[model samples]
Target: MAISNVLMFGMVDFSGLLDKFGIDWHLLLIQSLNFVLVAFLLYRFGFRSVARVMDERREKIELGLKYADDMKREKAAFESSRAQRAESARREAEGIVKSAKDGAKAILEQGKMELQQQSAGMILNAEKEIARRRKKILGDAKAEIGTLVVEVAKSVLASQMTDRDRNNYAAMAEKMLP
Candidate 1:
């Protein structure tokens, strides 16, 4: 076939050159088929494997990201629970301290009450002892006064009486006897 009428551009035509080089349509068709076959083979052998590896790597990255997110959520939950527990423990400790303080105050008050009661009882016992001692002293003084009066009367009568007076006194005393 003549390539002279196949103008590549408006001024380029090389029919004689193509005939001299023996280039034909069949050769072009075979070269195009070979290029297509080689491209398909390279795509199947190299690019497909590389793309599959890249896809697997991407999937792993996504999975790692998801796992990291899950771990973060778990850590946050743990911290929240820990904080709540700490708060609860603090409240409980405060309550315990308050209770202890109240108990101590109550005990102190009870001790004061007991001390007052004991002191009052001691004072009462002391007063009773004083009264008893006073009564005893008064009784002893009265006994001593009585004894002194008896002795004085005996002495006075003995000094004033005589033998004749004693005999008349006995006669008067016998007539007056009931």
Candidate 2:
């Protein structure tokens, strides 16, 4: 009740000031009504459309931001997948190279063994040929030495021999020739 009395007292003083200023209540009420009508028309016709457009723009901006974030995540996932594939390819390439090296080594070893076998076979064949040739040469030399000894004995015995002595010496030489 006291607060109401105080508010009424302030209103009385304010009304007296307004009267002194020649502020007519009827003119004030008409102006207030005009202002309210203008404000309502402006809010309904202009501000509502502007607010709707702003809301649409805000939604579009949010969608664009969400799309950008999704794209970033997708790019990160793609990069991770690509890196893993690259690592796998590297390992596969290394494995292929290692296998190739091992295969090459095996081939080289096989070739070396084959070459050694061929060389050993060739050496054995050459040794056999040499031994055969040596044996043939020794036989030929022995035959030639025997023929020379018989011819030398014949010449020496022929120079001093009668037919009877020749026959006896030839029989003895034939017995001793070998």
Candidate 3:
């Protein structure tokens, strides 16, 4: 009977409590609806679009970073290969020089001034030819490497760039190239 009396008498009544705090139910309902509408509008019209744009920019930046890393790997590989080729060329050039000197010594053993002079001329001509071939090889390798670098840059830029980025990178690459 005590529980029933308490429940029946107004145990949950807020009327007097709300009145003491100057809270009006009608105004509270209106403000709650207003808050919901404003939140929905902000999310729909402002935050959603901004979030999408941020996501797009984030993706582009990530792709650019990945392309830069690939470029570093490719450049390292190119450098290693170029070094190997240069070392090989140097060793070959040294061997040719050594062989020419040996032949010149053999011809000098004949003890004729004319043969010695002719052998000296032959040795000098061989040295000149060796230098010419080495220079040509180095020039060809450099031209090939430069072409490969430009092609790689073009491919990377095509994949990673906006038009503005493409133009900027093209300008930069041109500046880097002779």
RMSD of each: 10.4, 6.9, 45.4
Question: What are the clashing pairs of model 1?
Answer: none
Q: Where does candidate 3 have its weakest 10-residue lDDT segment?
A: 165-174
Instruction: Say which candidate scores most in lDDT.
Output: 2
Q: Whole-model lDDT for model 1 versus the true structure?
A: 0.79
Cα lDDT of model 3 by residue, 70-116, tens digit: 99999999999999999999999999999999888877776577777
Best by TM-score: 2
Score candidate 3 by lDDT: 0.81
Cα lDDT computed for each candidate against the true fold: 0.79, 0.86, 0.81
Model 3 pairs whose backbones collide: none
Residue pairs clashing, model 2: none
Q: Which sequence of candidate numbers ranks them by TM-score, best first?
A: 2, 1, 3
User: Which residue runs does candidate 2 get wrong by more than 4 Å?
Assistant: 1-37, 40-45, 149-178
TM-score (C-alpha) between model 2 and the true structure: 0.61
TM-score of each: 0.58, 0.61, 0.52
Instruction: Give a tens-digit lDDT track for model 1, residues 75-123.
Output: 9999999999999999999999999999999999999999999999999
